[model samples]
Target: MPSLATTETLIASSGRKSFRVVFEGFLHLMLLACAVVSIITTVGIVLVLLIESLQFFRDVSVWEFLTGTKWSPLLKPQHFGILPLFCGTFLVAAGSALVAIPIGLGTAIFLSEYASPIVRDIVKPLLEVLAGIPSVVFGYLAVVFVSPIIKSLFASADLFNAANACIVVGFMILPTIVSLSEDVLRSVPRSLREAAYALGATKLDVTIGVVVPAAMSGIMASFLLAIARAVGETMAVTLAAGATPRLTLNPLESIQTMTAYIVQVSQGDTPAGTLEYRTIFAVGLTLFIFTLLLNVIAQWILSRVREKYE
Candidate 1:
């Protein structure tokens, strides 16, 4: 029913709208492509690990692998106990949490509640810089600097011990905890703070009692993710925690984590298709499963927390 110019204008508007729809569709498709790539890579790795671990289980009983007390795979009478590796990983993860939780939460509280704009600008960047340091550099520092100090302080400390690796890994993951926790704390509604202030609550009281509780889920998620990071760390553990898989809780004694064992087996002269080669894949599978579980738990906690707060 439109005239020629009016019809052209209408057609142009339709075309623009169509183009916008197509562009949005394309953007969504691109995001799907990224997700697909990630899924494919993860599936491929899992499949490889599963196959190799099946082969390993064929030679070594599942029960033995799971329950054995000795773990000397290269010795004449090979032992395949995973307990020592689990202990080492837990020690490092626990130690990392001990180090990261206090410092990280304190930093987060300071940043969100106490710090002025200028102080925050300086501190946040410095905290991020900690994350930027290479894992290998941290490994070197653990071996060269931390190990000696630990050995000096502890009478029973081994030159290469779980303590050194745990301390170093803790430092490495500190930034993650601090930054994520700070962001979560900062995201709390200003109205909440104002209400507390109106109630005559001190800044420290409001921050510790209200804000921290509100952000507890997010902080917990950060801690779990940091634990996952510590568990999966390889280089620092390999360099600082000697390649001795022994089931002990003594932090000063040398130990080998699952990741460190994988690194050891991979870097050695183990031929392809051999038991040692397969063992690395098995260990990798275990490490992958552990980290995946931690991440899933973290995500779950984060979602629940967000739902509550939002």
Candidate 2:
């Protein structure tokens, strides 16, 4: 018994509701698909690395891989010790951290707390430009530019040394740490700084004591990510660091990182199913595991800091 106009209104309302439901469901399905895509891709990579590494372990024992002091898998009498690669990786990573953390953190603090709008605008774009440059370019720069300077400064340093690799890798990771850390520091509530200032604290004290402490979780997270990046760097280190795998703490000496060695082996004409080819997978798995632990630790620290703040 409803009027025609009233019936038409009811139909329109029902149609709109139905359309909205369908549209919302479609959006949700798209989001779910995006999420699953990453998980599936990660699973696929892990499976391939795991399976190939298993084949490698059939020929070489895990203990030998973990504790071996030498890593000449391609040599006739193959020595599969991974410790030398680990040492070189750690040495370069440590040196890069030395350079990146301090300089990057200082840059972040200046941008977030001290820089004027004009200065921030100028410096930020410059930093981004530096970051956008290709890693291969950095490697070339390290070889042609940084290596000579390092050799001059440290007379004993080799042209292709761990020191040069560390210096270039440090530059490579600086923007990541600085950009993320600046965001974290800037996101610290202004009220915290004001309160410290109200208590007669200096600008330096307010920044270092209040703002930096509040943003510790995010800053620490950035450092960890930069370290992981340094660890995974292949091209820069491969070109800069010498192809020699040695267990030495001296930055002046030539050495090869795990990633560099992997690159070296892959560049060869080793056939598939050969020991040389399988070595790359084993090295990849080892590097993956090492980087995974660093990420887990970073997450744990970040979570703890977040809990405290909350």
Candidate 3:
């Protein structure tokens, strides 16, 4: 038989273990509830967009809004065409992607494969500092600095054209691309690199042939995230890209994006119930849907990549 003291110690240990289990269960429940809040909030926002957009559609045909060539909702014989907004938005987003992808990818590769720990520690912080800067600041810079430079380069370039806005938006998105991509690259198993090196592969070969392919999903995700950021950016695009909704292919000309339009109208005398004001919800819903599609693609890519590794 065990001694009384030993029996008592065992009972005390059991009691403590039970208490820990109970405490841990409570923590898990709390975390689960916290996670649910974000999902609920997202669903709630979508519902609001849908409800308000439906209210808009009651007055204007969905087909007309989607297919209209002009977007002058407030003018006489108003045309509620979304094409002009979509075109401008796409052009700017594409430009931002062009700027961010190559440069951000290169930065990620350098940080992941080539940089010393000290360099990474210094450079990483500096890159993240860009993200902390407000969108309005970037907008101001776009107008005062970027637009002037572009104008100097091409004498025909208009102030507050797509090019300046694109450049600024791209710069705004660079940090997201670099940070996420670097994390993805760094997540590649060290053993894979070791094995490649053991098989007589050079560092370049391993990085290019092995690490990059392995991290493709994450890199693509980063790119999509950057695209989404540029798509939704308001103040910068507003200040830089003039509010001229048009179907122009030239970067030298001015344009307005969906976000810029919504911002423009929301700041004015738009009372809540008017059809003019309801256009905001419609545009917002479109934007939400576009972003949702991008996120869906990202998730699909992530799943496929995860499957490859698994």
TM-scores for candidates 1 onward, in order: 0.90, 0.94, 0.89
Worst 10 residues of 2 by lDDT: 301-310
* lDDT by candidate, in order shown: 0.87, 0.92, 0.92
Residue pairs with colliding backbones in model 1 are: none
- Choose 1 or 2, whichever is better by lDDT: 2
Q: Give the alpha carbon lDDT tens digit for every residue of 52-76 in model 1.
A: 9999999998888878878888777
Q: State the TM-score for model 2.
A: 0.94
lDDT, candidate 3, 12-61, per-residue tens? 99999999999999999999999999899999999999999999999899
lDDT minimum window of 10 residues, candidate 3: 301-310
Number of backbone-clashing residue pairs for each candidate, in the order shown: 0, 1, 0
TM-score of 1: 0.90
Pairs that collide in candidate 2 are: 68-81
Evaluate residue 26 in candidate 3 and report its C-alpha lDDT on the 0 to 100 scale.
100
What lDDT is obtained when candidate 1 is compared to the true structure? 0.87
